[model samples]
Target: MDTQLLLLLLLAMVLMASVAQRFPENSCAQYFQYVQSGIGSFQGELTLGLQNGRNRIDVRFSQLGAHDQSVVGALLPYPDEVTVRASLRAAKFRVSLWADASAVLPKLTRLVYNNNELCRASEYNPQSFFNRFFELHINGPQSPHRVAPTPVIHKFPEGQTDVQIKTVVFDGSERSISHILSDFVNEQTATSAADWAPKSPAITSISSSAVPRQRWPTSSVPTISSIAPAPWKPATPASPFIPNGIRASPPSSVPWPSFVCGQEGTGVPYIQRGMEFPRGRYPWLTAVYHKESFSLAFKCGGSLVSTSLVITAAHCVYKIREDRVLVALGRYDLDNYSEDGAEMRDARRIVMHPEYSSRLQLQPDADIALITLDSPVIFNDIISPICLWETAETETEAEIGSIAGWGTDENGNSMTRYPRVVDAKIATVGECARRWKVQKILDRTLCAGNLDGSGPCLGDSGGGLMIKRNNRWLLRGVVSLGERSTVDHCNNNQYVLYCDLAKHMTWIRQYIS
Candidate 1:
């Protein structure tokens, strides 16, 4: 042979060796062709190499219809073997191609190449061959292409799909393909792949092999549709009788002054002595009277301090005939009057503290009254005894004290008799004096009630102004006058003055006996 011929032969042998080396020791590359002789027909499957590498295969398809045909495709990667399948069905003809797994080259170990040149064939093209062979879709059919509908993405692990592929290499190296299809599905579903073909509609068959089924209702039942009922509304609260602005005052700013006597020509001395009751020991105490007939009556609460001495407010004794006064002691409920209930006593003489004035009745001295009962009250739970005054040189106003009367709560709303007695801290003399503009808080009287409007009102007068000393309840003062003005001139101030017991301990003792 000539030298040139020998060189050409050597070159060809080298090329063959290189190609053989590229494939798995025994794998071979294959080509496939599919012809869709009609419109709206397609089928295909792909296999991936276990190892990471490129794969090449040849594919062909035919378009025999007047309108453009669609083809669905899928790629599945595997570890041991790779399979490629494609089918095309037309009205007149059908074509199918399947690449055996064992015979095909491992997808991970092959090199792929494409033919850039374009050609038109009868009912088929070379581009399909390349795409199907390599398990990839090549760019073609730009116009008149059908786009696949987007897929809906769901929260994963719940709606995840798994795809796996396997291939067997001649060298016995196994490879696998596994991935969560959800992410890819989600991305493809979200993005519009311009080159993708629309999915084929699912195929169904009605053949003789089908069994007969029982007839059932196909029409949906008409629903008597109803809506949820509207939400319930809340009832309104009761409006208070006192003015909203008046009730808004702080409980500590009320202008309550000390009740004073003897300076005003009232035969009553500045101080009087009486039996002193210790705290928590007033179990002998009783209610001398409680108002029941008058719903709006101001004499709702008072006590019998002595047998003849019926202690009450001058105002409560105001505007009423002395005959109307009926004292009920030892009673829990005013509406229920029985001998076994609160002891009932009649009033013969009602002598309000002479100095007790009502000019504004704003002064504390004018707030007190001494009503002399026709007969002495017998002590019982319904008519228990309350300890009276103890004469002292002077009683400090800051002494921790309590006022027990049938007064209203912070809102001036009356409470039931069972829990009528309300107690609050006494304001300092300086604070009370400053707020009320009283020059001298008499030695006979001490001041109580919050500077606010929280002191005695209409009914609380003449009630015992008891003090708690060493856990004993003492009558320190009388619940005399709260803010006297009906208009609440001292707005926002809740002060109340009491007839100081220390000044009257002597008189109270003599008169009660």
Candidate 2:
């Protein structure tokens, strides 16, 4: 009898050990840290602690009016085995597995309440608790949700009161960081596809038949071996991107060295109802082309940033034959053969951001690219490079910037002899969300244009939105895609979205440096 009792006790201990292994004691803490780190600087009145060996997060939703069943029911009916309990101001969610919890995040939005999605990420307002929780659980800290998140908390269009999550807790395993990031990517792709239509006016290249035929034999193109590259020098105060780095001082204190880049030519500016760019007003402007049957045809616009590097939209270069890519610098009048200062060079290499995708369900995160020319561009007064934007604060201070391209004219016609530049005001995230009807805008992209139809149009994709500071033109944004309200022309009534250059400093520096 004694031997049997000892054996039974041993068996009981083994069973308890197995259960403990499956549900570790520190699982909740691990999950909390991962979420907290992801939340980054958006930490509001969110607190994390352990309750009965389960991780609990305490969040207060002062904006919800009242923490009642209405709020709880919208978050229901729970994802399978997850358990949740709510009080007046606090809630506790015991998640057996974080993976199962992924499906619950979207239901937190107003869409679950049967309201039309007035804007994407309606729940991601920092003023509300759900926004922090969602960001914490979805996007990682370094990868911000939006560059400048909207501060306005929109009310439901309908009479129904919106429920905002104040405080909540998640208890789960330590192996959640990787899973969470994976979910973020997947969700971003799906949400992007749903928000922005693939048929949007991404490519502005006019068909070859529209333009006069120009013969360019393959043998006449410059090869990498035949061209000698000049020694390119880096500009002053070499350092990584500073968020508001140059905001404290005036532009004079941090003057960009014009010897290398950011120098405008002595071309007279002409402004009418539509702005017309003179021969050398915007010198950095470049025209990217693709080889057709026996002649080169205009494809996209680009900004020459260095001796051999040109920046443009990724969609312009993606999946195209490398040898067929050509760039023409110092070109002003496309139809005028008498125009001087134009030099065409074959593209040596094209580098598109790895994250760039046109998949049905993918985020338009990295719609930028860098092209290396076969030969170093001989910079002239009419063909110098432009400076990459150094500070994010400059954008806000300027408010409005200039965009130039030989896109559709005011009448939505084909390419004209000369390009035009117009002033476009920066738009807010909330405004863009409503205008574009998107759920989320990547931090690496921004929206700007005029409601009167004075923004980028067909043939403008890959062009630069430039801002003048201290008498120098700086590249701020790239023309990505414009609202296609009409069939063949850009919807001048809506705003055009541009890839934010400020957000990709690290990636840009890697190649330029």
Candidate 3:
């Protein structure tokens, strides 16, 4: 072989190798990386990977030693991250996608950014966008991560409702919740909940399953990870439960504070004039217990927000320092706590709404509070988290709602033994204001009861005035102040006041997350 020819051939081979290196092996696996030192101490990688009309993104933190919450990254220069997030609000952001996919791929229809179909818009309908959507997989969502949950209730042009529950049966043990509820229903007779069972949103009506299996083009269902991510949107992904601008999404499992929604039925004995809840009628119903050095007494009522959370009133837990506070769930009868499903756990932390100044007495405004249990409780039918009302429908069907507690009875006696649940009608705030004085009926307060003297009494403070819908019970309000004339005595004639739960979701979820 000629020496010159051999040298030319070697040079050509080397050039070809360089060209091969320049081009990627898998065209679809191309990605763009952004190193965000993050707001405050949060330093993470925001990445986007692209494939055929699909996108997968991961916003992950670069673990630089352990995070020191005390570290003030502010006070320094640009290289050092800020300790506070105030700057984030004023800054205009820019997201850079490295590939030519945006310009080249115009027919892009489907998107799986952080496992959500972010962009449903095509070229003609390019108006939808979800802003500030990012998913960081830190320890498989066990720790804190963004999970956007869609709203359960929405007004539709077609007059239909979109529920977000996944129809596919992914787990053998995971049967339809309706079936579990139905099974619980058939076991016995009589309930304090409303008579109507919750109607399941038509399976076909569920709007957020990333396009049903039948709707897809006949080929293969694409795994979300295989696709590159798309731009953020202001709209949440379709869902059966509404996070309602709460989080990017809810946890994979049922979101925290998942109480039963809209349940009311008849069949029981008594709480005062209130009927006794069937063995475990109100699963989320709990008693906030103040555990003293030698004794434990449940003086106020609460509702379980999650496996590790409870919701009560500020007045119930604010200053009763005589005992360490604890939360008890699923206790049927105070006399017979040996009743099944009742579990007690110390409150690890309590977050009273910052404005809630209720001390020994029930304040009409800002009476709400949240209690973080030391550990997550094992949830059962009798012990579980209840859902909060997404919308405040003060006037429920027939203007009816119910309150359950160990208040005084019709005989003008205190509710010392068997507690009862009873029905009450929603009352106008204006009337309540007139009855109590302008300053008494606060904006956060709601009044409900019967004219015939069928309402909450003493010892019912901090209890919930619940409303039933769709077979689940939603916490509508926390018992704040009873009519002063009837505070010490049992009187259905005077309307009872409650701190509206529906109005204070923003303040509640802030600490819950």
In candidate 1, how many Å is residue 413 off?
3.2
Pick the TM-score winner: 3
In order, the Cα lDDT scores of the candidates are 0.34, 0.49, 0.45
User: Tens digits of per-residue lDDT for model 1 on 403-509?
Assistant: 44444444434433332433445665777777678675544445654333434455455666665332123455666655545432222245566766566555444
- For model 3, state the Cα shift of residue 263 in Å: 5.3
- Candidate number of the best lDDT: 2
> Model 2 misses residue 257 by how many Å?
9.2
Predicted structure 3, TM vs. truth: 0.50
Candidate 2: tens digits of C-alpha lDDT, residues 1-513: 999999999888766543332211222231121121131111111112112322212211212222222122111102211222112112222211121121222122221101112122222222332221121121112222112222333332322222211111122212222111111110000111111100101011222222221111122112212122222234433332212111113333332211334545421011112466445556689999999999878878999886678898888888897798999887878885434436787888788888888652233467888888876654433566777887653334226667888777667575756777777777777777788887866666777766775667878889897865443567888888775665666775687777888888777776654
lDDT of 3 by residue, 302-405 (tens): 87755567777787887664238977775667787554335777877777788887442347578887777776654443555455766543443235566777
TM-score of each: 0.39, 0.49, 0.50
Given candidate 3, what's the lDDT at residue 64?
18
lDDT of 3 at 444: 75
Clashes of each: 72, 8, 49
